[model samples]
Target chain A: MKKLILSTAALALVAGFASADVVRMGTEGAYAPWNFVNDAGEIDGFERELGDELCKRANLTCEWVKNDWDSIIPNLVSGNYDTIIAGMSVTAERDEVIDFTQAYTPPDPSAFAALDAGLDVEGGVIAAQAATIQAAFIAEKGWTLIEFATPEETVAAVRNGEADAVLADKSFLDTVVGSDGLVLLERTEMIGGGVGMGVRESDQELRATFDAAIQSMKDDGTLNTLIAKWEVSSQW
Target chain B: MFSYCTDPEALEGLAWLSCYLTTGKHMGLYISVVTVLVLLAITAPVALAFGFAGATAARSKFLPLRWLGKGYTSIVRGVPDIAFFMFFVIALDQGFEWLRHQVKCPDWPDAIRQGNDFVVCTAAKLPLSASPQWLHETYAFFLAVLTFAIVFGAFAANVLFGAMRAVPRPQLETAEAYGMTRRQTFWRILVPQMWVYALPGLSNLWMVLIKATPLLFLLGVEDIVYWARELGGTKNARFTDYPHGDWRMWYFFALLVFYLSFTKVSEVVLERIMKRLTHGQATSGGEAQRRANA
Candidate 1:
């Protein structure tokens, strides 16, 4: 048993180092259609497929690292990963911390999910995941905002009547709405710039590499294909 | 960071892993291990003091003091520790904010709990929204430690109360015969002799405390278990440098070893302390030592 374990460790270590010119991509695996852990316990969804194609086009060996959404950019900046492809939308506040490549997906509409279709979303208590654009939007509108750590909890808050509605990315809420008596409200808030790959400010060369790949993907319509297949944001 | 680590793409194998393991997030994991140790060190003593106070108060001559002490232990101990943790941190944070809100925003028109949202004035926010991330994390750690101390302190009190009572009544009578005051009997006699009885229970509590460190994650402290799950999930070539299939089993296995080794060390240390406490006392442990010495 000991020998078998040692041999496995040795093989894994050797296999791990075989790839040179590697790019580490960071994502939050909990967000579906954007990036999520599939039934096989492997990361799947729109960003995952797009990231893989981008890495292949860039001729860089890449690996995925799942990080919490709350710390995704910080982890990227601190060298835990080489890039953030975690469905993160471009924003001025985030730009101050790290650079973003050309957007792969267009600005996704933020929608409200509530128990009642006629719920007063504008003035009612709102739920959003902390540190998200939706959360910021709610706070900006001066609505009563209750924040949870994860997206699921935001939905749970609305279901349990802790909040009147949960505001989230339409791509995320599309699969969630219509179940558990959740109805999508009519009001849609288009917030944030298009979703893009995030890189550390110092990684200019890496950013340029990904930007070229993303541009190529956009020109050839492969990015739009993946976006449509995953039913994420509208085509570029 | 090593010299070759400057270009992560050029690195392979052990070199790649060396850099990967030394990343800032990994360093956070390493530091959080220290956080657990620090929590245990601080909490054990604080909880013991609380437990001592509680046990002593339960034996108090004053009626209200005794009731207060017993009530504290019963109420805290009756609720599940997880439920207590979830309730206490929010309650304590809101309690502090509410107090500050009353003082800071006395003229403010809005009620704090508007519907389900607990909105304290910006000035009254705990650690403030604009405070640095480390300050927020530190405040959370402080709350976690306080909650752990309160919960474990109650259990410790129960053990200590029984231990105090178990000290022979004749021993107190004998102290009285020697003209020792009630205070002196408790301090010089009852307190001193109770430990030989208490050490076994306290040692068990120590093990439980070590096991309970993982609960820090639930309180949003990002403890060792949190790091394990974060780092060990499946990573394909699409997202990170070190791509692997679901390696959570391995990461959790490493945690298992860490906890076992830690508990083993605690057991050895507790055994030594037990020996020291039992010395010359009229107990089975002291009798065993006397026979071995003879």
Candidate 2:
């Protein structure tokens, strides 16, 4: 029995580093501010900066990979990438497939940045993709509306004056509205978002290392400086 | 699942209810099927109209008009359909606005093309800058329809042009020999008989049109394929009232069944239409019809 326990512990030690210091992280380069690709072809978003800091603190070398927006979760579960640092929210459906680190960023009030006219999310029926917090908020408002396949379409709707405003991520709210002459009209109580790290179920040790790195960044003001540089936090 | 379903106390029952309501995405699933149907209903007629015009133009005596028709038909078959689907809608949208820009904002100094971006005057926006919600969706749906029609119309024109050519040379000669004008021969002898040849090709186009409807999702139209993937997945506990596991695969399976059944039903209906169109004509199909009936 003692031998079996030691073997199990050894196996656990091996499993912990499944995605060790040389971490392969995935981000949606299309989502601006959070993790969008700039004209220079480098991933230069808030999450990318934060991801770098976390890796630095963890003493891990990192390789960044660009992927399609929707495939992030599937790739994570299948071990295609070590972790997803995209501006993804923690939701019930995602919990089943993979584990997420505690939210590093709190969700800010979601609003649509309309290119055409000023938008008031309070009066308009909430329109967000289903299963998201935005969708839940719209449901809470007791309004019915359409859901789009991507943030790009949602933004296009506002630009075309198709939707009043898109219920969307905060970092995107700034980039889209700033670039397109859109304005955010409201704010909601912030919700916690899964904007930290992701690891496979077997990589509990890897997850712990990420959690420790995040904590260290917060302790050393690396997180704050990065946040200030990227302008990711609205309230910062 | 049923016994446990009402038990807020029992996780198993709650799981069932969660699955039931969240799987309500099935409603979205069915809506996409209608999207495919709507795409077909609109595209078929628009394509037929485009094809008929193209075929007519190709056979025209005038130089530019015939070239225009032949050009339209040839363009469709050469490039990939996806390329056309992507290019035409944007190109046509810009084409409309560019015309409008010249007319509406002619005094504006800025060039519309600045490197990579397209910037037109606010007044020149398609559907205008001040249109309502329904107008936008309708506008998108209409653009999608136009794209589908323009692409499929070329294929239809190919079928139609061949049908026109298949009419016997003697038939046209007889009309001319009997002192009929070219116009008279075309109308009296050629046009009506062409349908007997065209039905087989037209029927095939209809089946292809059905197959192409799923592409609506790619065009940003929230058709059935969009809804199926959205609604068919399993919900987890982080979500209350609709907690289930990943079920997207099963939902897509149902969609496959729906599409298969729809295609089977169409084949039977199209076969019947072919017989009706070919009946009592002088072509082989028509002769075969008469002999079989006799």
Place model 2 in a CAPRI quality band. incorrect
Error of 2 at B215 (Å): 1.9
Index of the highest-DockQ prediction: 1
Give one digit per residue, the lDDT tens place, for model 2 in A167-217.
777666665555446676655435545465766665678789988887777
Which regions in candidate 1 have their CA more than 4 angstroms from the true location? A1-232, B7-10
Worst 10 residues of 2 chain A by lDDT: A1-10
TM-score of 2: 0.55
- Per-residue lDDT, model 2, residue A138, is 70
Point out the worst 10-residue segment of candidate 1 chain B by lDDT.
Answer: B127-136
Predicted model with the maximum lDDT: 1
True contacts kept of each: 0.00, 0.00
Error of 1 at B92 (Å): 1.0
